[model samples]
Target: MWMGEGFVSEIQHNRGREDTMDDVGHRYLRELVQRCMVLVGKMGSLGKIKTCRMHDLMRDFCVSKAQEENFLHINNILSLKLCEVQNNKVRRLAVILESDENYIEGVKFNEYPYLSYRVCCKLELGNLNYLQTLVNVRPKTIQIPTWFKFNLLQVLKVRNKKGAQDAIQMLISRCPLIEKLHLYGHLKKLPEAHQFSPNLAKLTLSGTKLEEDPMETLKKLPNLKILCFRQAFEKISKYESVGRASFNGKNMVCSKGGFPLLQYLFLGTLYYLEEWRVEEGAMPSLCRLEIEFCSRLKMIPDGLRFIATLQELKIIDMPKPFIDSLNEGGPDFDKVKHVHSLVLKSFCQRMIIVSS
Candidate 1:
């Protein structure tokens, strides 16, 4: 999330070596921890911080220092003092209301139907160019009534919409620069190839019903690098077809020349995925893959053995039989033997981490 907002973009620059946005973000966090400004809360098995926080004193002190120095400046001129300004041309607007610590009883949340967060607002994006994040209620919470000519809208996430595919397809047409899109609605159809933004690097969809082979369309995205599907499909075993919708069918295929720039892929909650076939040359740049809650997936794709670029694989909450197939001398062992990091999480909360 910090990476998408350009928070640490200037922290690590041309220092003579390749530095990814992930490395920069982590390094910035480390600096804060070293200075006692932030505290690490939870750490992942991969040594990454999953959660963190800052002391109230530290936060207060930082705010005081920033305000004293007039630090919230854009292009080194316009100061962002938010609430104090009467003018409405600062690009992005987020309303944050701070109240007393006393708790109020029996206060109906329905009383404030106009409230929206990321700092509760009486929401309206009336052509005020800079778009950050607008999280609201159902599908009707946001409406792009007028065409956006100039916007800083890089990321968007919406939920509970019936026509998610069409809505997003129309969105990308107006804000053609959106790089990261996360859809939480139930989709009846996946968007076509030409409907995507050429600059898109990450795509995530959850709880969608597929009518066609999604990979057939997703692979055509020119710059997509990260893809995640969470509870995106449900199982219907009686009516099965090979090479059809992955959830409705027993088999799915990843043909050659697909996902050319993709590097990270995650599939979770796919209950009936039994087989995934990857033809050679598919996802050639893929480095990380994670699969969780896919209880019926019996084996790893044989084509993955040919993807030398794959460096890490993580499987979680899978059936014992599925986990056993990746053991030494097992049928699927040879396919993933070349991966540098292999992590398997069991139902008992036991995790096996292997680095080869």
Candidate 2:
């Protein structure tokens, strides 16, 4: 999200540097952690912070300062009217929706789990050419203007856009610099992966019941580095959505040359995934892998056994039989023996099998 907003992305790092925008973003985050601006909420397989939380005092101060400077704005449609934004100029905006307009005005902030505050927005996004990040805006609320040209937008997030496939595609086409996209809604169709922004590096989708195999399509994305899917392919009743927990299986195959610069992969809560194949050279730069609650997956892919770059593997909420198979001398044990750190988590127990 920081990268998309050009927070750390546009930094003219060292001349002729090889670091990616995503790498620069992480390096900035690490600096924040060192400064104690936020607290780590969750950790990934490779010990990177997957989520973070800010203290109430810090959060409020930042929000107040940002709004005062017109540097950031929060358009909470439930209580605050869109037309009432302090200033017309904002570099980044977060559009929050709450169907019920009546609510307690908490001293700090309120959380509205239900969405949809529509049509009254009237804010012309087409005029906000300086905008860099537009997050959590519902298509039903603010229709993307036909003349929209957000050349500086780098991060876009949309929620509960049930039937706005064409509008979503059109909106994406207008944001030439968009790099991170997150879609959360029950979607029946998906835009062609090839049509995605070529500069896109991070993508996340949730609750999308795509009729087409998403992997087969997404594998075509040229610059994708980080990908995540939650409850998109798995049986909804068997597994609930886990934020930022990436892949949920649906007949996925990692073909050769797919996600060439990818470093992190995650699979979670896929109930019927019985097999997964990874061809040689697929995700060749992958360093961290995580598989969680994929109850029916029978064995680890044979290709993992040969991915010399793989560094960490974490398995969570898996069946006992699956855990046994990765133990010493077990059928699939050798496949993961080379991993530097191997950890597994079950409902009642957590254990580390190996560490380097």
What are the clash counts of all predictions, listed in order?
A: 0, 1
Go through the candidates in order and give the C-alpha RMSD of each one to the true structure. Answer: 9.3, 7.4
lDDT of 2 at 76: 69
For candidate 2, lDDT tens digit of each residue in 1-356?
A: 46545576465455687776656877888888889997888985335677899999999999999988877878665555434433434445576656655332212111211222233443335556556667766665554467767776767887754587776767677878778888776566667775678888888776655555576777787877777666543333666633322333456688887878777777766555778899887888888888878778887899898788999999888878888888788898888999988887755565655545
TM-score of each: 0.67, 0.67
Q: Highest lDDT, which number?
A: 2
Alpha-carbon error at 63 in model 2, in Å?
A: 11
Q: What shift in Å separates residue 284 of candidate 1 from its native position after superposition?
A: 0.7
Among these predictions, the greatest TM-score belongs to: 2
Give stretches of model 1 more than 4 Å off.
1-58, 62-126, 135-139, 163-165, 232-250, 346-355
For residues 118-161, could you state the per-residue lDDT of candidate 1 as single tens digits?
32223344453645443333444445466553245556665555
